[model samples]
Target: MTDTSKKEQLYELIRANPFVSQQDLAVELRLSRSAVAGHIASLIRERRLLGRAYVLPDKRPVLCIGAANLDRKLRTLETLQMGTSNPAYAEEVHGGVARNIAENLARLGLPAALLTAVGDDPAGSALQSRAESAGIDTRGSLRLNDTYSGTYTAVLDERGEMVLALADMALYDKMTPEFLASRAPQRSSAAMVVADLNLPQDTVATLLQDARRDAVALVIVAVSQPKMARLPQDLHGLRLLVLNRGELETRVGRKLAGDAELAAGCREVQAQGAQDIIITCGGEGVYHTSYTLAGEAGLTWLPAPKVDVVDVTGAGDAFAAGVCWSIYQGNNDLTLACRRGLKVAAMTLESPDTVSPLLAADILEEISEFHPLHLPQD
Candidate 1:
């Protein structure tokens, strides 16, 4: 067989049995052990295989803590009327900042666990079941008895832009610091811990503290404008902070404009203890800064790939997942990680669902033909 075919065969076998040894491959393919070793080495060098197995060794299961809810969207076919009922089509799907991020990570072939509260309602059951089916460990999740599951309802215009929305996330209030303390072992063992602002302020504080104590990378996703204030004032020990310009402005308590101003805002947050900051600008793209052992890094901006916008909802969650996945894969390059995030966000923009099933596959390959925008240096 040609080397290409031999490589393909080796790839299939390794993927099928991640722990398969070289002797096993030689026995199954009726080839010399040396031949199998050569093919495997080629695969690893070509980037088709990751490390000694299909997954990286340091890529441990991520612990995602926040909200899991049923998302309801009402899309109007025509102009919406004010103070009057308008005819529209409605759709419901699984959603929640943390829940979506966890599912995205699982779909990307990473092991993920979710720690959040859900009601004893059917919607709650469906959410948990779907997450588990996607390979997320939901055992850390809570099923509250007296409350109904949280929900996010959005009214969209014909163009798919959100016109208005309501979030009934009172259920997340039950996910307090004391409750998280009960799950300390699981929290401390994860390679990374992600939390959204939907979590109570005290709960977020507790998570930050635990992340510091355990030396786990803590990634925070700012849920929304109003909720951004819930984050701890001192962001020290935060590994990554993903948010939009508005959210960053809110966090810094100032209005920022221009690249210089935004870069300064990133530095302000970094001074307060955040190691890396990614601020997403709608349509324009994403800007990121990181503090490494070499000292402060310059701002790197990657423009968003042009795509048809189907729905803006959940795009941020997708972005968060991509960045976290890159970090889990042991990539310390902030610019590349932000590009991965932008790629996932673009995929979400093309789908009405919070997360497109297409995201379950290799995104880099899917967009290989497209070129990412490179901004001019200052």
Candidate 2:
């Protein structure tokens, strides 16, 4: 056969049998083993085959695109002293809205990927390494020279409630439309896309536009009340929007009073184009509603299981992860999803870690609720 014919045959063999060895390809293509190796290398260079054993990059992961930061939290031991320093304990961890959610999904045994800009610094290295170790695909993440990784330092009272938070995350502003476009292949292939408001307004718009074009589920998680302005006025392609009551009020440009007012505010956000809205009330519970082709699904409230709060940092992200996992598992019931979200949030609140290392796939099954464990007899 000609060189072109040999290469074509080699690819066909690999496609038919992904586990076919180089030696088998040599015999199948009537070429030397070395020649077969060359052909395989050529095919990989052209992006036909993904990796060893002819693995394909075909997994439809939950694509999370936004900030990844180094987190520092300090909790005071004594009563309040605003102007002067108080005795406290400090802890550091890898954190960011998207990053924390991605870690949670990965820990829940879902295929997850992250696309975010990180500085080529030690902290950034640790961030990527930790995500990869947690089974998050970070290949599409960016590393820029001379940019220090973003940092979020939170000060908490003795009760573990956040008092103030300071952040230096200018690096995410560099995430441009061009950068997002460069990762279009990932976006197009995702089962769903989750983004945080830490990104710039234009970048968020680009992501929303791309999600609309690709007909993919896009979920937006608000990072903070101040960053709510970074969200575009049009959220037409959004599948779900998870935010706190304060963030929702900021989005609706009004102060929400009670459940009725919150539902109205959610409708206002729905008018802005979010398909579903989940407004977390921390310990109180969550207010949520879903929209379909017909019309608005009725709003519902689910109280969180009462638990002693250990740390409140990861509760929101964990809740978002729980809802995302439920949706990924084909459960569109918003009430049940919020139940799972509340469960995850409660678990995270009891742990001091940001992404709760204790999360596992089995947590999705509420042993106390409907699901029961049944083991096979030996």
Which number leads on lDDT?
2
Per-residue error for 73 in candidate 1, Å, reads 0.4
Give Cα-based local distance difference scores for all models.
Answer: 0.83, 0.84
lDDT by residue for model 2 (175-230), tens = 88888877765665578899999899999998888778877788999988999999
For candidate 2, the 10 contiguous residues with the lowest summed lDDT are 369-378
In candidate 2, position 318 carries an lDDT of 94
Model 1, residue 306: distance off in Å is 0.8
Please count the clashing residue pairs in each candidate, in the order shown.
Answer: 0, 0
lDDT of 1 at 164: 95
* lDDT for model 1: 0.83
Give the number of the best model, judged by TM-score. 2
Question: Which 10 residues in a row give candidate 1 its minimum summed lDDT?
Answer: 368-377
After superposing candidate 1, which stretches have Cα over 4 Å from the reference? 1-59, 290-298, 365-378
Superposing every Cα of model 2 onto the true structure, what RMSD results?
A: 7.8
